[model samples]
Target: MNIGIIPMRYAKALFAFAQDKGMEETVYAEMNQLARSFAEHASLKTILDNPVLKSKEKQALICTAAGTQVSDIFVRFIEMVLHHKREKHLQSIALMYQDLYRKARQITIGSLVTATPLSADEENRMRKMLMMDKEGTLEFKATVDPEILGGFIFGIDTYRLDASVATQLKRVKNQFMDKNRKSL
Candidate 1:
């Protein structure tokens, strides 16, 4: 996510590779599950980070552990990383692939941070607003951020719209100071 260049490169390559191998869906599913697993088990990632263990061995261990739950393409992809000595970037690869897969479906991911939990009607209204503005279809995930105080902050891709009470308060304070300075 942070290293945009690297993730993009890896994601593009992986997307193409998966497509050519006729395992795009399998890869996408496996990558998503891998990302979830990485989030839930930090220690598992550390094990993958072991420099002493050869990449092939590490991948084999993961493939064996994951077993039938993961696809053959997923296992082969892991092995390819070990073969290339890029095992350390496995997590990043998974994240990048997930992003690529989502984007391919014209599904943009957005987040809404609200002062409080939004009611179903309110959430639907927001979704409608987004749909009206969106160039393509999108899926949004709302998060409750009490620090916003009252309003909401919407984020999509790299753009964020902060229409929050916290920001409104700051604007009001700045306006007051400006007016006072003008009078002085």
Candidate 2:
């Protein structure tokens, strides 16, 4: 069986089920939390994959990792996943559900990384400028990363614009090295 197919199938079912129950938004939030838990805790996968852990225990762990409280639809989905011994793909399922939700709702996810934090006005201006050419609602998140040295990196969906000083310096360094090699 294809590994990717399993998560997609499960996620599609969960998305449809949540929509039918009018809990899609709640489930989406829970899935995002669950996905973040998986990313932040590498041991989570190892614990879920442990053979000694009972289904109930794993279920409890997953529910706790999701958030303070999850929707009934999410709980039922987790039960179904545990019942089918698909706990190993829980992370992927959560991420897939998020993707499905975002696509269905026509939400565009974007991120801005800069050496320094932008003021609220600046952030709003940036968001407005970026949204000018894009369709649908934009969910913009700004993060600070001093490693970039200066300037900013903007990304919307799969497209990324890297104008950071560090990256430019690296490109210049690479070009110098190549020239030196050619001259040698």
Candidate 3:
């Protein structure tokens, strides 16, 4: 069986279960933290994925690491994963769960990268414009990257809006090369 399939199926099922219980937000955050913990603590993965460890032992280790804020349902979910020997794919399951939760709630997430930080007013205006057409809540984040030279780049899911000076220069350079080649 494909490893990806396991997580996708499990995550979809878990998302549905969480929705039925009206715990989507709580479960999403717990799953996100679980994924982050796995990423940050390599030793946890080593322990959980070790074939020598019993399922109960692995569950204990994971429960200890998952923090007390996680719901009992989430802890049981983890136990199920361990019992089924799918610990290695827990991170992927968490990510897929987050995606499903956001999509179901009609949420849109976007990021903006600019040469410098935006003023409070500018940030507020940009956020309003982005959310204006959105049918649901928007999660917008801003970052500064001087390497963009000037201007900004915004992205949401698969779509990107690039207006950076670097990208403009590249477009001009490509056009110049095309003209030079035609002349030759």
- Give the C-alpha miss distance for residue 118 in model 2, angstroms: 0.6
Candidate 2 ranges beyond 4 A from true positions: none
- Per-candidate Cα lDDT values, in order, are 0.79, 0.94, 0.86
As for candidate 1, its clashing pairs are none
Comparing 2 with 3 on TM-score, the higher-scoring candidate is 2
Choose the strongest candidate by TM-score: 2
For candidate 2, the 10 contiguous residues with the lowest summed lDDT are 130-139
Candidate closest to the true structure, highest lDDT: 2
Return the TM-score for candidate 3, rounded to 2 decimals. 0.79
- Descending-lDDT candidate ranking: 2, 3, 1
Clashes of each: 0, 0, 0
Candidate 2's residue-wise lDDT over 57-176, tens digit each? 999999999999987888888899999999999999999999999999989998999999999999999888988986788889999999999999999999999999999999999999
Model 1 whole-model lDDT (C-alpha atoms): 0.79
| Candidate 3 RMSD to the correct structure | 3.3
Candidate 1 weakest ten by summed lDDT = 59-68
* Candidate 3 accuracy as lDDT: 0.86
Q: Assess candidate 2 and give its lDDT.
A: 0.94
